[model samples]
Target: MSHENKTIRNTAPGHPRRPLADRIALVAGATRGAGRAQAVELGRAGATVYVTGRTTRTRVSEVGRTTETIEESAELVTAAGGTGIAVPTDHLDGERVRALADRIDREQGRLDVLVNDLWGGEHLLVGSVFGKKSWETPLADGLRILELGVRSHVITAALLLPLLIRSDAPLYVEVTDGTAHSNRRYRENMYYDLAKTAPIRLAFGLGQELAEYGGTAVAVSPGFLRSEQMLAHFGVSEENWRDAIAQEPAFAVAESPQYLARGVAALAADPGRAARWNGKSACSAELARAYGVRDVDGSRPDAWAYFEAAAHGGEEVSPEDYR
Candidate 1:
């Protein structure tokens, strides 16, 4: 499918007016998933977005997924009505990230928003075990995950802080999973949990650190995200995703990554968004309620709430039933 076909029109009742135009945004890891959706949504709001990732038309990353490319992401952003600049970047290399930031500084002279969505843990966790006992995964793989997931965000933030500080409404968003205090353990192997949690804490630390710089930092998670990978994994397309719900009940409430993307755009547009910052990790459903934006299906899916209810024996639904 083409990117233009994926573009969603704003047809929901009581949809708010466009508030972001001529803003500058940087969406790291924009090759796919939430990063791609966020880039397109920011573009839809009329922002010049810099979409950075390792996967481009010229080369592919270690993950080997080839459904999307940095160039394709950039095109989708442009189709959404904003300038999209695709810069192939391996976030592990600090110098490359710095160079991209320098170019942004030279050209735009300011940045309105920065989103760090870099993650490369899927391949590493393929054969890992996480049953009765936790085994120490390979230190090398663990460190690599940290490099892509955590250190990249720190380096990007450091390189772009100056430009972000120049914006009237500077926002730093850390894309992560779950809220801060959610004690639920991820069934994934050991390294995956550590990699994901580190970014959440980084957001907490940065939110405190950036307070004096007049920038807001917050961790945002998509609820049961129906990402491109997940859709393919379930053998379904977004247009016919409802068919998959017959196999997994939660699929009935699965949210598109674009829903979270719109939430990030809305947060960036809010002038007092900083007040809601600080260690707080929000889900797309919560942000949708707060921002009054509807999902493409016109129904907000609260995945966290569903999980909580199911865990507490409040809901009898099963994953298969939702599918």
Candidate 2:
């Protein structure tokens, strides 16, 4: 375990606040992308965030990217104004997850927020599942997707919910790829579809159980996110993201990871979140509009809405309108 403990302070000079100062949060699979951003934003709101992933400074997970690690995420969380603890964990391993729960119970006594964002199956998307039929897809790769996206979340929630329920009002966030409304159509492959939709069902089921304890559960999705991997796929960087629009016009509505992070942070800080969001499915755009939050670039992009509109032969409005 690596710890980054700092005296809690304001997020910026002369703007002191700690809306979630007393909160304890665990962000599973926070090595990079949306998970890392979620951890950083929760820390910015003054929550003690435990960032966990299979990757560390000394090791790399099957995702095979070593540029970002859990240790780095913890440091960023601490820099964002809250305590950050990095624990190297494999959510798929039941024993390791149980040990993590025991450690958190020993230290924090209670957990206020649980963000299960443990999907690392992006590498299997290209030739494995996207264009191939289920029968043509590799059996091992198909099953691995389920393990990463669905089983990992189940194990984490099962091991950690005991501590989470101890809180006065717990918040369980199931981070998936699409909203319930958007995923109504087929997602190309059987395994991929099930993996993405499982969290929506999980959130619905958990909401019912958590309601008795004054807890809230919701699944959230980010629109066409311009994550590090996405940028690499387009052969562009954040500063040059607009260049990718020539190849993929839809990229015009792509949002930064910070956009979704801000939305999640606002949701966490909202006093009436249980009444407004419990058992619901939300996207970054919906949360941004609801919370009056904006992306780091000051625009609000609704990629999901834009896609839905385009799917119905409605190209009347440009992608710029969505932003």
Candidate 3:
């Protein structure tokens, strides 16, 4: 991918097809998972989207172990409707993120939406006691997760704040794993817990800071995201993913990355989103009710509700009741 955010004109199927027409958005870490889905959804809604990640067709990031590339995500965004530009960037590097800002200024003039979904801690989760005990885990591994999962987001927001503030009602989305209440308990792993929870606080902080400027920030948590990484780890495809439920009971209510993407798009589309949701954390089910969008299966899965009561609270969860 080039540093120049060139416009790509291609067609993708399954467009949600709303009217973001002249809107411009950036999805950091858009190689795969929620990042890719959010980028594509923004494009489907008719917004020019800049898709950024370290993984490109030529090379892969150390944190990711797959063939997925930011170029592919950009192409999908183009196919959906709006222009998609791929930019390979490591958010941890200040100069790299600064260059992204310069490029956006040169290419698009300003940014209307920003989704900070940079999480590449997957490599640390395997064979390691990542969640069982924080201090027991390797210090190097723990620090690495904080660097990739948390610090990158902090750096990105600082650099891009200028572009974001230029918009009429800029929407800043901090993508985390769980809601504030849901993540109250230690997330089985210390480093992972800190990495995920920081974004929620970041959103609240940004919300308070950006209010007078007509910008809104909200931390968005996805419920049991059936992301590409999750699918591969479970050794199952989307069609046969039910097999994973047998292996882990929590998989029963898992939703796709698109579910959260829809939530992001809905928040961006709402005119009063800044007033209504500023400083708060949001979920897919909440957005579905507000925006009236559903998943690919035409059902809105409330994974967090089911997960909270079933997985953690020891209550039986019905898919219909939650969805």
Best by lDDT: 2
lDDT of 2 at 267: 91
Q: What is the lDDT of residue 254 in candidate 1?
A: 91
Clashing pairs for predicted structure model 3, backbone only: 11-79, 12-79, 131-188, 131-189
Per-residue CA lDDT of model 2 for 1-323, tens digit only, reads 32123223232222236688888999998999999999999999899999999999899999898899999999999999989999999999999999999998899887889999999899998999998999999999999999999999999999998888877778999999999999898889999999999999999999998887778999999999998889999999999999999999999999999899899988988768889989989999999999999998999999999998996557676899899
- Model 3, residue 217: what's the lDDT? 94
| Candidate 2 displacement at residue 231 in angstroms | 0.9
lDDT of 2 at 114: 97
Q: Give a tens-digit lDDT track for model 3, residues 1-323.
A: 22233233222323335657778899998999889999999998989999999889889789656579999999999999879999999999999999999999998888889999999888788767444577789889888989987999999999998888777677899998887878887787888889989999999999998886778999988887898889998999888888998888667777888888887887787778888899888887788778888877787888878877776889866755776
lDDT of 3 at 99: 99
Model 2: lDDT to the true structure: 0.91
Ranking by TM-score: 2, 3, 1
Q: Candidate 1's residue-wise lDDT over 20-82, tens digit each?
A: 675789999899999999999998888899999988887888988877899999999999988
Q: Write the number of the candidate with greater lDDT, choosing between 1 and 2.
A: 2
Q: Which stretches of candidate 1 lie over 4 Å from their true place?
A: 1-17, 129-133, 183-188, 312-323
| Model 3 misplaced regions, further than 4 Å | 1-17
For model 1 the TM-score comes to 0.87
